[model samples]
Structures are given as structure tokens and as C-alpha cells.
Target chain A: MTSAFALSDHDSAQLPLATELIAVIVASSGGAARILTIGGGDRLPSGPLESRHRSLQSGLRAWVEAQTRHQLGYMEQLYTFADPDRTGSAPNVRVISVSYLGLTRESQKASFSDAGWRDWYRYFPWEDHRAGAPPLIAAAIAPRLSAWAHGATTAALRRERRQRADITFGLNGHRWNEELALHRYELMFEAGLVEEAHRAGADLRERAGLFGRPMVHDHRRILATGIARLRAKIKYRPVVFELMPDEFTLFQLQQTVESLSGRLLHKQNFRRFIEQQQLVEETGDIATETGGRPAKLFRFRREVRIERAIGGTKLPTPRS
Target chain B: MTSAFALSDHDSAQLPLATELIAVIVASSGGAARILTIGGGDRLPSGPLESRHRSLQSGLRAWVEAQTRHQLGYMEQLYTFADPDRTGSAPNVRVISVSYLGLTRESQKASFSDAGWRDWYRYFPWEDHRAGAPPLIAAAIAPRLSAWAHGATTAALRRERRQRADITFGLNGHRWNEELALHRYELMFEAGLVEEAHRAGADLRERAGLFGRPMVHDHRRILATGIARLRAKIKYRPVVFELMPDEFTLFQLQQTVESLSGRLLHKQNFRRFIEQQQLVEETGDIATETGGRPAKLFRFRREVRIERAIGGTKLPTPRS
Candidate 1:
């Protein structure tokens, strides 16, 4: 057991410290889900920890609001990363990046060039299964993952890799769990299929069929973490409204949920589930732009939030 | 948005860094729940983060093992507190206390003199509703809480405080949620009923009847967080075995669950719930320690953990 003084030999008063903020600001627009991005959509909206900020959450909110001029609707601290290797800068510098998941109503608040929204799937192509596992999984990911698993040196290691690939990628007749966005991404990175796994040694030209557009530095990993949290959270909480407008048709609501969860829900079952939960109420208005027929508009019933903390959104479980 | 370099104009490299480890080691013995404590049972066993530790968890494990000579099992990070006020050491010192919740089988590993476990109910008497609401609530707590709620200057504030008390403490006919250990503590603190609320002022002699045994600093708050997490987690995960011996009777198991949750579960319903979950397997052993009749002993099924991530213990929800 080390005393406070023994733990720090340097007067216990001064040490090099740095704190960074990372935000996975997500929104839904035009039936497609997008994430707030900077630097040509290669990095998540992030900034330095300023002294002016009151707390970690405030610092993250300030950074996001300044960039997009959109007030963060729902925000929660996701995780704190402090590994020196994750900093992606000087080796000696100690940087702590506190990541957050923020959701807001879709808005054209920022320009297309600077800080703007990009399709989240563009960075996580394998996560979207709305179109039946997205041909990319079979055409590209599966073969590369199988090869990577087989390329392991020892038999035991090869068997381990194969099992991991099967579980994470939902291969070998396993049910594809839509909530495993981070796990799948991590598996790809571990197999050296993602660009992040080859940051140091980029000599592999065979990476063509593998990598999703890489973020600046593990930002995509953080984004996947946010996506996983959102997917799991929406099932138990009425957080999907954070991505929807003031009033939306059931089809639009279903699309937004499908866009985020990467799974198409059964329309009749979803409608029944929604009605039973009483999470939304008809707004007495109609949306004429449905392209089929005018649909009734509904707004989230905020009063239900006060009745219980664990209100379920009642999104149907994905049928594999 | 502040640039990383621009945000650190005042020689940010020289900022003082301090890392503290707070442990919420819990156990059950003598049909009562306990938490590991040091410093005359006023505070949890904690230490400054040492460089020798490979990681935060290792540091916490090392500290606990050294102090109690008991090996920790089922450890998980509860929460991280970075607020300077939470440190209660120095205003300028940047202290990040990453609290962890550790479960160890109830053991005679440490004497009652040094680092020992104390009944968790001592710090949270009102939380226990096993034999119905504690008399302390109606006798000591309810009147004081009512007075506090009425003392609010504005009517809206009074109504808000009363409503919060109702939800947290299950007043005004609201069902007592056994999982809201943290919320109840916070409400008590906010109402200035707990000792932590009167840190600066000593003039309130009336506060003698209002306080729980005060911990050294924010340790009680940390414990509340751990309790809240455990209460919520036990429903979804089979973590209770960490507190049990290798094999135990169903009654003993039920007692442990009741002790930790601070709520009495229906015997037949709890048995049915446990049996349906298949979280445990009969050990083909009978314990004659039962006062009435010999009871079948069971051990946790470790294989269930690998089979699925979201295994439920299915302890009957408290009939409030």
C-alpha cells in the first residue's frame, strides 16, 4: 500500500496533464442516420478541455454547440480513454479523452464543408443490416475475416480466431446481434482488416476489400461505442425522439429507428408496440409528403418520462 | 471551438495530476450485508494510485488484498469522479477517483480491528424494507422530510421537493423502488437530512436526528453509487454468487438477495423465479442447518455466463 507521498515523488503538486473531449453527436435526416463530423468527416467532433468549462459534460457540450450551433438534446458520458497509445500524439504527453454520446434533432446548422454530418454507415458499413446484411458483409468482410482467422500461426490460435469471427460477425449460422457494433469493429481491428490496425505498417495493398473509411485516430471506434449504446438504449428508453422532428409520421419514426438500429422492424408489430407503450400521441396534423398516402403526425408524450424512469420504447427485437 | 494548443495557453503540461482509488467491497455474513471499511469503519479502504500498478483495477485489487488479505472477485468500475469538490483534499489538485465495486465471499480474512466489513444498513437504515418499512421512516424520517419539503420558500419548490421525496422514498403512495439507493441518498443530502449536507455548519444541533453515520468524505456517496449499481445489476446478471460460499441452500440464497436488495422477496415466488432462470444447479447436497427441515444446496452454473451475456437471475421483484 503506497502512501500519497510515496506514490508521487515529485512534490505531489505538479505533473503534466491533458484532457480532451470527444463527442459522437448523432442525428437523423432524410431517413438516413448521420453523425456530426469534422476534418472531412474523418474525425468525430472533438476539442480540448478548457478551464472555462465547468465539467466534462459542459466541455463536450460547449465544443459541440460551438461547431454546429445545435443544442445537444441528449448527452451521456460514454467512456474515458487514458491509454498513452490511444492519444495518437507525443508519446510522453498524458492525454485523457472523455467521450460522450450526444443526440439532437436533425438540422442543417453547419455548412457541408467544415463541420457537418456524414452518414454513420460510411464509417461502419458492416453495421447496417437493414438491406439484408448489406452485400459487403458477404462480398468483402466475411472472406477477409475467414482468411484472417485461418492465417493465425498455431492451431489453437486459429480455432480461437475463427470462433471469435463467427461470434462477432454472426457467421456460422449465429444470429446477427445489431447491438454489437463496437465488438464487430474491434474484431475487424484485431484481425488487421481495418485501416486503424495498419496505422504503423501500411504496406498491405490487400486492404482494399477490408477497411471502412477510417477516422483520424480511433474516432470511429468511439463512434461505434456510441452507436452500440444508442442501439441498446433505444430498446429500453424513448431516446429515438431526440433524433426526430417535433412531429413525425409513424413511417418516418420507424425509418429513423431502422436507420439507427440497422434493422428493419415489422411495421404492424412496431405500430402496436408503440401504441401500447403510449410514448407518442397524435398531433392532429398530417404529413402529405409520404409519397403513398397522407399519414398522421405524432409527437412524443413527454409526460410519460415523469411516470417512470425505465420506460421502454418497445422497438421490436430484430428477427434474424 | 478551442484548439487543443490554444486551450492550453497557461502551461497546461504543469497541471497537477492526482489519481485516487475508492473501493466498494461488499459481502454478506450472519444474514446481513456489509461493506469493507477502514479508518474505524468510517471510510472505505482506498489509496493513492501508484505507478507500480499496471492498471487502475490492479491498483484497487492490490490495495484491498493488502488491507484485507482477501482475494477480490467480480470487480467492475462503478463510476469516475473528477469534480474538485469531490476530492475534498485541495482546490487546485486535479484528483480523479475511479471507484470500483468488488465482491468477495464473506470470509474471516480480516479481524474486526483493522480493515473490516460493517453492516451496510448502518449507513442506510431507511433503505431496508425487508420486514416492511423501517420504523425509523415514520418515526424519524417522514416528519423531518415533510418539514423540509414544506420549508421551501416557493410553492413550486415545495411541491417539487415533496414529489422528489415521494418518488425516491416511495411517499404519497408511490411504490418503493429498491434499486434507487443512490437517489434516496441524494434526496436526503439535498434535504439536509444527512451529515454530508452540513459539512460547513455546526450550529444545527437539530441535525443530530437527521444524519446517518458520516463517512470521512464522499465515501458514503460512492457506496450509494455501488449499491445502486448492484441493485440494478443483480436483476440482469448472476453477480450474487460472488458473495456466497461454494454451495448454499435456496433459503440462504434468498436471504442474501433480500439482504443486498433491502427488500423482502416472496418465498415461493422467489423459488419459482430462481428455478425458471436455471442460474444455479443442485449440488446433490442437503444442508441440515435449516431450522425446520433439511434444504437442498445449489451452486452457481458458471457455464451460463458463456452461453449468453444477458443471463437474468430473475429474483422476484419486490412486492411493494
Candidate 2:
């Protein structure tokens, strides 16, 4: 059994030694945008850093193959960090982790035995802005959060609470910027309305209910991290290609972006930007069978890839 | 003695065992954009995941505070991944890690016995677009990378190599996008021109002398991660506030954004965007005497922060 309070501040300071990786794999599925997860958990495919690996990229591919067995379409290193105390009970144990985000087609959604896939919006229900803010956001959360903000003792404190609440959960005519996923999650967590709190022996289920369902461990929070990165990414990079199929109608691609970003795009402008940037070349093939008018199929130009590969392959971030 | 083998295929099936957090802390020091580093290494701060920790944010704050003692502002989890065989000899051991990015105003630099700060431009010399790309870009790197690209034996490979080099290093009638910081570093690293390899087993004199001295470990690589993130960040979020003092002139703020992003902004367009967004408010203050017109001081609108905490801050992503 673990020692009583084996994690004193001094001892606690020495834990968390393992280094790992997390990836956010996004794709369109069932006409709805979905994020990839392993074993129904919000975690993306990840593994540890090993010295045997030639470089970080190779090591990442090896682990990814071993777990999912599907070839990765595209991958990039997101970031890396280390734990001072080493999460293991051993003292001076340090682990270094490097994380990557990968993209694959939903056709490869084959599940791994210990893995499962869940919708990203399940964890961040408020993020689905396609149809506008869900009613629960206004009727359930707004008023409750307002009450909580007013619960502060002094006027200044009350104002500060209101400001924080309003910012984290867009209030008083402030437009909800879908990208503050992590901050919004943190605010809910601090308020003791997250599942991790119950695991940690604190209870804020009543408040947590206003947010959304929490995940096992830090999974929900990690999902927020990936969503924020992806939301910010779609604006400037051609990374949307990774989530797209080889042959896609421009509208299909546009909807995918709109779906993940939780914001609708102006069709003409979106089409004009994509065309001007030369992100896609017309396949000369049209898909008229499924829709009103035939839309041309476009293949991601593997050429602009050269110039935009680093900064991005897209022009005009999705600005309304 | 440490264990000899820590990785096996079966060992890989289990989820990553350790979670690590790497942080890219950026600040302006002495008129130059600088990156924070630790342990006399190349770049950034990092730590591990612990069961004792309440959540990822608290865990990261604990480790970061231990070193810098400065509370972080504007933090976002960057990525997470695990490498089971990171230790080389250890085979069965696995680790998981979560990475994060932190932004803060430069203060009294922390005193890490082995750590020091370096100007970010020193690493990617070509990125300094404050005055636009210097002649050195064409004179120094273009020819070398061009030759290397054409050095491939097969025609197919040669053309690819050429294209990759041209776009990555901005060669042959290409515009330089400052956002490709990581691409630039990786390209140079592969070319064996940077000082980092020389610090390893590679010889110093034989190195291509591309740009900048190298850090002791993978610090340069981590530095690239930070650079790429900042370059992408400036385009969307109001994170520039983190680098600014409590109050500042709009011009000073623009300079900071341009400095980190390595791109010049159309002053009129930038000001218009700022004003229209309602992201800032006059502080009823003014400053003058820099041999130019006196300017009003403004603090970020604490309220509109509720409006665009995520993608509210716009980046002048060049469509030009």
C-alpha cells in the first residue's frame, strides 16, 4: 500500500517523472466532425522517448504503428517536457516526453483492443457552435455561473468573478471564441466541477454538471489541449489536408473546417481563398450525383506544399 | 547498473507510462526576443506527470515555479507523447508526457546555475525581418541548400530534394515566410551546418557554419518548437499582452509582435484591426519623446478578453 501522504510537498515535488506523447487526430465522420481517440478515451496515440530510436520522428512512427497498426498519414512534433520528481516512487527518476499530432482518414477508424474513439465535443459540449450555442449554455450554465460570480463577498471580488466568468464563458453580448477550450476547462476544474476533483477527494459535481461530462484521469483536459491546437491550426496551415480525403468537393472541405472551428465560413470567400492559394487542383471530375449542382473534385496540390509546408498551405485564415 | 532492455513489442501495447510537460517560455530581454532555458541547456522548461498531482496545470505550475519562481501568464498545453525506450538501455520501462507553452513579461532573469538566455534570432539568422531579410539569406544559405538539393542522384529524388530545399530555405524566387522556423532548423540540422552537431560527435570545423552556436543538448530543437509556436500564436490570440507591461503604446506592442513573428505589419491595417476588435482601451495616459509624435497608452480591454480569448486576437496572416 502507498504510505500515508507519501506525497508531501517535498515528496510531491519529486514525482511526475514520466515523459510521454499525445496526438490529436481529426477527421470528418458521419457528416459530423470527430476527433480521434484510443479505446474510447480522449487520449491520442502516444508512447515514451527511447534512446534506441534514431530521432524523435522515427520513434514516434514506431510506437504509432505498434499501437494502431495503421500507417500515419501525416505527423508533426508538437512539444516536449520532462518531470523533475519522476512519477515513479524512485527518487531522481526523470522522464522526457515528446508529443506529436497526427492525421489519418476516418476509413481507418478501426479500433484497437484497448482503444476506443469518442467525439471531442463530448468532452467540450459548449464548443459545438455550428447550430449556435446550445440551450444548456444559456438556461443552465449562464445563470448558475452568474450566481456563483455574485457569490463573491466584496463588490470588487464580485466584479472580478463576473469578469472571469464572462471571459471563460462568453457573457453579456461577448462572442464566444471557441478556442479558449483549455481555459474554460481550467475554470470549471478550479470551481470543483470536474471529475478529476472527485478522484482527488473534492466534490463539485453540482457545479461540474453545468460544464459537461469529465473524463477519466486528465483525459478531458488533454483533449482540450488538442482541440485548441487544432482550432488555431486550421486557420493558417494546410493541415486540413490531413483530415481530408484524396478527392473532396470544395464544399466538403469547407464544412470540415467549419465543423471543427465551430464557425460557419462565407462560401464565396472560402472558395476564392482556396482557389487563389492553389491549395487544391481540380481533378476535372465532378460529384453531381449526391447534390443539387455538380461540385468539382480537388486534390491537394502536392506543389504549394513546398512553400507553405512550414507556415501553412492556406491563405486567409477563417475570418468572418 | 541500469537495466539493459526496456522495450519490447508487448511492452509497447500498454499506454504510455509517464506524462511529461515541456514549456516554451518567451520574453523580451534588452530589446531582443529571448527564450528561457534551464540546466545550462538549450531551451525551455519541462517536468513529469504524477499521480499525486491534482491535475496537469497544477503539476506544471509546481515544477515551473520551483525553477523560475515566476507565476506563469497565458499558458496553453502544447502536446503530449510517450516513448517507452527513451533511455536506450531500458527496454521494459515506458513513459508518458504532457507539454505546455507559457508566456510572461521578462523580469529579473532566473538564476539557474547552468541556464542562460539567448536571442531567438541568433538561431535562425534569416528570420529577422524587422528590416526584412538580409543579403546573407541569399549569399549564405541559398546556394548551399540549392547545391545539396541538386546533389541527389536520381532525377525524381533530385527534383524533390530541390523543391524541399527551395521552399524550406526560401530559395529561387520564393518569399520567405517567417513562420517556418522549425522547418529551417530541421533543414539546417540535416545539413550538419549548425553548431549543435559539432557539440556532439561531429567535428566543428567540418560543420557548414550555417547559423548560430548550438546548445549542450536538444535545446536547439526545443528552441525551434518554441519559435514555431510563437510564430503561429501571434496571428490569432491576444497573447502579445503577456509580453507587454501592464500599460504600453500601440507602436511598442506592434514592435514586439513583429519581433517575435519576424514579419512587418501594415501599420494602418494593424491599427484598424485592433480598433475594430475593441480589444484595447485607453488608459487615460500618454508617452512621448522618442523623437516622434506622442502616443496614447492603452491597457488591454479586460472585458473584451471575454470576447476573443481564443481566436479573437487576429494575426496579419499575409495573403500577399
Top-scoring candidate (TM-score)? 1
Q: Write the per-residue lDDT of candidate 1 for residues A103-153, one digit (tens) a residue.
A: 897676665446788898988888888888888888888898899988989
Error of 1 at B104 (Å): 2.4
lDDT of 2 at A198: 63
lDDT of 1: 0.78
Question: What TM-score fits each model?
Answer: 0.88, 0.76
lDDT of 2 by residue, A115-229 (tens): 5556667777787877777787788667766877777789977786677767767788666767677777776666555666566455345644356666654656666766776
Model 1 preserves the real interface contacts to a fraction of 0.14
Candidate 2 C-alpha lDDT tens digits along B1-320? 11212343435433333344566677874457877666654545656556555567777776666665656777876554444433222344443435567778867665545445567777667778777576767777777667766777898777877776677666776667676788788876666557664554555443333476565445566667678877776776677878888888777877788778877787777788788778889999898754688899989987666445544556654322
TM-score of 1: 0.88
Task: Compose the digit string of candidate 1's lDDT tens values, residues B252-276.
Answer: 9989988999988888888898888
Please identify model 1 stretches exceeding 4 Å from their true place: A1-15, A67-69, A139-166, A200-211, A309-314, B1-15, B66-68, B111-113, B153-156, B202-211, B268-272, B310-315
* Cα RMSDs, all models: 3.4, 6.7
